[model samples]
Structure formats: C-alpha cells, structure tokens
Target: MTNGPRVVLAPDKFKGSLSAPEVAAALAAGIRRADPTADVRCVPVADGGDGMVDAFVAAGWKRVEVAAPGPTGEPSTAVYAVHGATAVVELAAAVGVAKLPGGRLDPLGSNTYGLGVVVAHALDNGAEEIVLGLGGSASTDGGSGLLRALGLRLLDADDRELDGADSDVATLLGRVSSVDRAGLHPAIARTGFTLACDVDNPLLGPAGAVAVFAPQKGADPDQMTELEAALTNWAAVLGTGYAEIGGAGAAGGTGFGVLAVLGAQVRSGIEVLMELLEFPSLVADATLVVTGEGSLDHQSMRGKAPVGVAAVAKAAGVPVVAAVGRTLLSPGEIRAAGFVGCYALSDLEPDPALSIAHAAELLEQVGERIAARRW
Candidate 1:
C-alpha cells in the first residue's frame, strides 16, 4: 500500500446534496492531490436511515427494486439491498417524508403501508433475515397501516373493516375493536427481523411516538392528541407489551408493531451497520479518521452515522475529525463527541443554498484543508 498518514474517510450522505460515496470520492481525490503518498481509504456509512441501503450496496450487497406505496398511498418505486439470505430494507426508501406529495407533511394520513409491502416482498422472495432501517418517517399511524399491508385486518365494534387510510388515525383507530391476523404473510413466522435504529423513545406517552415525533411530521396540538389516542387504541387492540420498549416509537411506532407482532430484535443503527461493513478493521492502522454528514447538529449526537464512526475511530485510538455541510454544534460539543476537528462547508461558503449545490467541490477543498492541517 502507498505510504504516509493512513486516512480513513467514513461519512454519511450529505442530504440534498451528495451521496456518501460521492462525498468520499471527492475527499479521496483532494487528499491525493494534497499528498499523493497518503494512504486514503473511503468507507462510506449510514445509521439505518435514508442512506442505509446504499451503504450496504457499497459494501457489495445487491440492489433490488420494487414498486411500493408512498407515504400517502401513491405509487412509488423503492429499493432494498440483498446479499445471501439477508435483505436490508430502508423505511425512507418507501414511505419517507421525502416521498411526501408536494413536500407537504401528512401528519394524519401518512402511514407505513409501503414499508410493509417491501418487507413482504423480501419474505416472498426467500429472504431468511431482514434488517430494517427506521427513520425519516412520514406517519403517525402506530404502524397499523404496515400491519394492514401485511394481512392484518383492523375491524370496528361491528366487525366492519377500518381502513387506516380512510381518515386521521384518531378517527380511524378509535373505532378499531379488534384485529384479524389469520392472513398475515406465511413467512413472518420463519424469517428473522431486526430493527436498525438509534431511537429510544417508547411507543406511547409524553416522550412517545405522537408526543415527540408527530410534531416533526407536521402534527398540530390537536393532531398530536388524536394520534396519541389512536396509538393507545392500537396498543390495546394488539394487547402487547412492546409499546413500552425502547425504540418502539421509531418510524411512527413501526418498531412497536415489528417487535410485538413480528418478534423483531432492535439494535443501534450505526453499530449494526459498522459490524456489517467490518469497519473496525479498516481503522486498525489508520493515522487519521474523518467522518461527517450534511449537518452537524443536536440530532447528529443521537447515534447518527458520523457520531458512530467517531466512536469507532476513538476506540481504535485513531484521531477523528468531521467534514460536514454545516454545524450548529459548538467546538466544545464537537470535541466532547470525539471529533478533534470539525470542518463545515458553511465556513467556506456562507450561503446555504450555494453550499449544498457545490458540496462535492467544497468537500474536496475540505479534504485538502484537513490534509494540510493533520499531515
């Protein structure tokens, strides 16, 4: 291998800009331009969110495309990654907020039906294990819609069907009297399910699905109340204890449904991804590690890909830095989170719009800056 400082570039996608691979590629070019002898390795990563599937695909997984419903039941083409008997499914690839029509939030009508369709497809095609990446949701249906897609029937007091798409969750689920799972996909029992997430919020309560996440989906106070009631009713109908489990609130309670209904295991998103990518070994002899995302904010600290990568680098006794689009975090906060240096495109280009548009170029510049400083 070429010799100098062994630099590892591990970053998540710069949302609305470049993909993780693109970011790493740009950085690699710049680092080489600055120091041709430096041994630079690009290990793009994601934390079980929007770019999780891409990460796996970058690591040699096969990409599979399928027609699935969007957040509002619209026709959309989504993709998953498959390798061997395991399939990697990303919720954002199905009913993510980005799929919202006109980019308008649909707090009441959005659901996870599309996500369920993808999972079912994987199971039908003989996938023995599923790793679901949960984040960027656009619903507050407590995953009832997903269950419905998987052949679970929601009935009213009179045994009439209650369609989750018919109305707001409160209006729809409030009338749900029971569920019929006789038609649940046959493979559910045999296939193992794992949830890749960083959320620890429970399914119901002040810190739960509706109270904490609904607002982000554009739920007003009234809608939050309604969704809370809806999820509570759903939990009652299922009669399961998963509503109280950590991460049950993720992806609008998708975690709860998979846990209680499908018997899924939950794990840290980054942890799962890194293990799958065999990331630790890449850092074993690295001289410096650089990781980042689009924005370095409060949310990044909550087990986002960058933070997770930093943790791994630190554990390997490697110096870690971040190259991001923008940062709302202070230097002290960045250091506390294990990053020795934090570079932001915003520092190079003040205009947010311009920064995003030229992220690839700026990231290369950032890479050169890092090399000049570190080497």
Candidate 2:
C-alpha cells in the first residue's frame, strides 16, 4: 500500500441516473485511473430521503426487509437499516413516487399507511431509536394513514371505522367524529423517534404541504383544494399546534403525524445522516473531499447533501469539491456554497438526455479531472 494523498468520495445519488454507490464507484474508478497509488475511500451519502437505507448499509448496518403496503395498499417489500437498537426507516422505500403502481398517481387515494407499518415493525423488533427519513411521498393524506396503522382509529359520526388508504383527505378527516388511540402499539411509548426532514413548510396554508407539493404528486386544482381542506380538518383533530410546526408539512404532512402523535424530534435529513455516518471523522484524514448530488442549484445551497457535506469538510479544513450530474449554479454561486470547486457531467455531455444516460461515464471523466486538478 502506498501512503498517497487520501481522497474521500462522498456523494448522494444522481437521481434518475445513478445510485450513490454507483456514483461513488464510478468516481473512485476515475480517481484510480488518474493515479493508481492514490488512497480513495467511497462513502455514499443521502439527505434522509431516498437511498438512505443504502447509505446505512454501506456503513455496515444490517438491511432488514419488511413487507409493507405501497401507496395504494398494494403489497410491497420495503427495506430499513438497523444497527443494534438504532433503526433507520425511509418513507420513500414504502410509499414513494416510484412505488406507485404502473406510474399512476393517486394523490387523494394514496397514504402513508405503508410507512407506518414499517415503523411499527421496527419498534416491535426491539428498535429503541428509529430515524424516519421523510420525502418523495405519493399522497397528501397528512399522514392519517400512518397514524391509523400505528393503531389510531378514526371513527365516523355514524360510528363506522374509516380507512386511511384509498380515501380523499378532505373526506377522510371530515368524516372523523373521534380519534381512538387506546390500541396504539405499546412499544411506541418506549421508543425514541427522530424525523429527518429538509423542508420547513407547515402542515397548512399556502406554504404548507398540499398547496406547495400536491401538484407535483398529480393533484389538480380541485384536488389540491380538497386535500388542503382535508388537512385542515386533520389539523383540528390532531391539534392545531402540530399543524404549525416547522417541517410539519414534509412527506405530505407525515411529519405532523409523527411529531404530534409519536412525539418525534425533527432535524435536517442531511445533518442527521452525516452524524449517523460519522462524516466528520471520515474526512478527518482526507486531503481532498468530493461531494455532490444530481443537481447543484439554488436548492443545493439550502440544506442539500452536497452543501451539508461541504460544510463538514470545510469544518475539518479539507478542501471540498463537487461532482454532480448537472449544475445550474455559476462558479461564484458554487464557491459560495462552501465548495472550493465543482464539476458536472453536463460539462462533458451538453445534452440532458445524454448526460443522464451516461452519467457514470461522465462522472468518471469528472473524477479524473478532480484527481488531476485537485489531488
């Protein structure tokens, strides 16, 4: 083994192109090609959304596959990572956009019941501390589905039980005459929960979940209105205090359900994952740190993985650079985000389609450039 310059490759997934592991592998290959003697370490990171479990697994955590329902109540096998009593459950794994059946969107019909099932399973299996990463959700049920799964019963005025899935949010919550919590999982009281969220939108109003994110989930104007109204009623039932919490609107108000009912603490997804992965120590001995995501733009500077990683690297006095699939930020803007330099796959492949299709190849080239220029 040669005592060469140590290069740490830590990056999030290049969405729709490559997973974080693949990106790190391609970059590592390019770095090795540039200088075979260079010491390279691959540490894939995520912002507590997609690829979260993979990040934990990469760090020697155990992957536990549990059967949960998809957004539309379809059977799905989702995965969570467990290391000792600490478990990490990603909401996207159970009912994310990709998990929708046949690429069909059911904005009002979908719910987070599947995610609740996964969390319940984790707690039942002796998980003491569970980290719930919230994002990429497919529904706007305000997390009623999850709460129901955890043994909360929604009883209608007629004393009929309400189903969390396949029901419109407005109709669902509007019909709820009372909430029953006597059957809640016993382990819930004993477990500690941390919610990994990025956005700070409250659970209602213009800046809230339905108004800002329902459209992307295939909700039309009328559906949005209905969802908003439903969530309003949900807030009333769950107590208006939870509705106004920061990040309470995340994952279609799933954050509210967890925070209000389960009493979970909220935190930045990237920051939480960085702590779990021991990121500071990972870059402590590194000469150059590489970090990025699929895009480096206005959002990237605001609590994204690359920015989060850059902050850590900068704190350790290690120069940080980015290797993204594409970048919308100017060089000055990139530097302002705490990165010393930035590289993009789009730099080599101008076409968006070509860039995504060959992101690994382009990332390798970017990797080579990083080694030649920075290493």
Candidate 3:
C-alpha cells in the first residue's frame, strides 16, 4: 500500500494549447507512468491573466457567467467567480485581446469598461470582497471606462457630460477636464478590491504599459504616441500620481485606474493565488515540486506563476523542477531561477511544431523523467 515519492504537479497553461489543469494532468500522468505507485498532486496556477478563472475554479470557487460590454463598445460577456463573500473577476474574460472581433485588434479604441461591469455585478451578488484579475486586458483607456462602468460621471472640459463607455481612449480622456464622483457605485464604496496583476510596469514611461505592452496588443507607433498622450491627460485629470507607481501599467492602465479610483491594493497574481490555493500547506510534506509554463524565458523570473510556485516550494525546503514546452533561458539562468533542473519538450522533439502538436505526450515524458531523477 506504499506509494512512490510524493510529487506536486503545479504548472501554468502552455498557451495556444494545454490549460493549467491539462498540463498538470499530463505531467501527473507521466509521473504515474514512471512510477506507477507515485503519489501525484495537481495544483495548477496562474498569474491572473487568461487562466485565472481556471485556477480559482480548481480551488472550488463557483463561476458565474454575465453579459457585459467588450473593450471596443461591443456585446460581450465576462465570467465572475464566487467563494463566500469573495468574488473573482478576470479582465481577460471581459475584454481580452482574444475577445476582439475577427482580425480586429484596436489598442486605442478598447477600454476596461467591461471589467467594471463585472465588478458591479459582483457587488450586486453580495460579494463584500472582490479580486480583479488584471491580465489579458485589451484596453488602454486608463481606468476611465472602468470607473464609468462603476457609475463615475465623466465630463468634458466644458463641464458637459461625456460617455466614457462608448468613447475611445484618446477621444474621451482627451476631452475630459474634471470628474464627478457623486454618482459613483454604492457597492464600490462599500467593497474592498484586491488587484491581481502579473507585471510591475508603471502607468507611463519607457517601461510603462503603453510603451511596452501596446505593441504586443497591436498598436502602431503613431497610435502608441496618441494613446500615451491621452493616458497622460487621463492621469492628470484623475489627479493620481500612482500612475508612475509599479504595476500601474498592467492590463493597459486598468491597474493604475483601479488603484486610483477604487483605492484597491495591488499584489502579484501568483502571490495572491498561492494564498488562495494554500500552497505552503499542500507542499509541506512533498518530496518535490514541479511547475512550468509554455515557455521559460527571462520574464519568468520577474513574477510569473512558476517563479512564484518555486518561491513557495523553496520556503518549504522542497526541491523545485520545471517541465516547459520551450525555454529561451540558459542553464545558468535556469539554475538561478531556483530550479534543480528543467525538462524542455523541444530538447526531446527538436522541432517547435512537433513539440506543440505533441505537447501532452512530451509533457508526460518530462514528468516521468522528473519523477525518475533521484535528486
């Protein structure tokens, strides 16, 4: 009745393919294959972003679906999760880049208004505490649109009422001069918000969201400049210097806006997620911990889910290993990341397409090898 070594399988999604649970299952299956009696525990994780809901759901949070606006003033829906008084909202589900119309990615036109809609619904459903996952956001409209969704009265320089919901980032924030909080959401006033952000970029500057993330979201140079100026104006109009603070640039300025208007506190997505998943308790007696993402790169060290998982494992004195689909970091970097070793799918397949196409089988193989490693 004695099982093999106790190994914890915790990994993020492979992106464009396997999900965190799927990846964890594949890894677990491999561990089982290597040692048929091995005790495997799967606790998939995410740093906010797309896989946030999956993590929460796996942790037993109840998911609720709601109709909401998209980033670009279109019909869209967002999924909200509840576990007692705590509710989770994912920006990606509301207005993520994937939600954009076919072949249409408009960085300047999108906003976080959809996120506000989800928040409002959560408040209405008796959530006293809210967690907003600020990943996969498709808007750079500052928090103007989000605040608007929460009932803030946006006005132009002429003191006329302006619609932040249907307005573009530049057009709306460009015309705004002042704000009226008299009509702000009552629930927003009573609720406390915790922001789940993966990045530490500020609201404005070279490393800021606009400068670094805009391009990834499909904004050209001219559009970036224009959006930045509008964000600058939006920040000034709101009068919160938190724009320059770290994490302000997350989700296209949703972080900055939420922090400023809602008085929300920002924390690393993995940090928050660990507490939610009770990671330390689960890993306390484990012989080893396994984690990974789609690609292990230089960015992984900065607070990605795997790094966060390793931090927890290191604290518990458990050795950490990673099984990634691909890796762009060197051996030195990998060792520096606190991984005793890494198993990359590409190393086995040597073909990117084959690795992705056969990720499950490859991941299973990596898992078996990790279990087989004596150390």
Candidate 1: residue pairs that collide: none
Sort by TM-score, top down from the best: 2, 3, 1
Candidates 2 and 3: which is better by TM-score?
A: 2
Q: Tell me, by lDDT, which candidate is best.
A: 1
In model 1, where is the ten-residue run with the lowest total lDDT? Answer: 161-170
Candidate with the larger lDDT of 1 and 3: 1
The CA lDDT of each predicted structure is 0.90, 0.89, 0.87
> Of the candidates shown, which would achieve the greatest TM-score relative to the real structure?
2
Across 1-375, the per-residue lDDT of candidate 2 in tens digits comes to: 677779998899999989999999999999999988799999999987889988889888999999999998899989999999999999999999999999899997788999989989998899999999998999888788888889998988777889744456668877787788899999999999999977888999999998899999999998888888878888887789989999899999999988889999999999999998888999998999999999899987778889999999999999999998788998889888898888888779889999999988998888889889745
How would you encode candidate 3's per-residue C-alpha lDDT over 1-375 as one tens digit per residue? 545788888899999879999999999888888888778888889998898888888778898999998878789787977899999888998889888888488887788788888888999899988988888877788877888888888788788989854656877887888889998888877889998888988998898888989988889998899888888888898755889878889988988888888988999999988997789999999999999999999988889999999989999999999899888999999988889888999999988888889999999888878878875
**Model 1 — TM-score against the truth?**
0.94
For model 3, what is the error of residue 52's alpha carbon versus the real structure, in angstroms, after optimal superposition? 0.9
Question: Once superposed on the true structure, which residue ranges of model 1 sit more than 4 Å away at CA?
Answer: none
Better of 2 and 3 by lDDT: 2
Would you estimate the TM-scores of all the predictions? 0.94, 0.97, 0.96
lDDT of 1 by residue, 1-375 (tens): 786899999999999899899999999888889988889888889888898998888878999999999999899989999989999999999999999989999898888899999999999999999999999999987778788889988899999888765576678878899988899999998999999998999999988989888899999998888888888988898864889999999999999988878889999999999987789998988999999999999998988989999999999999999999999999999999999999999999999999999999998999899888754
The residue pairs in collision within model 3 are none
Candidate 3 vs. true structure, TM-score: 0.96
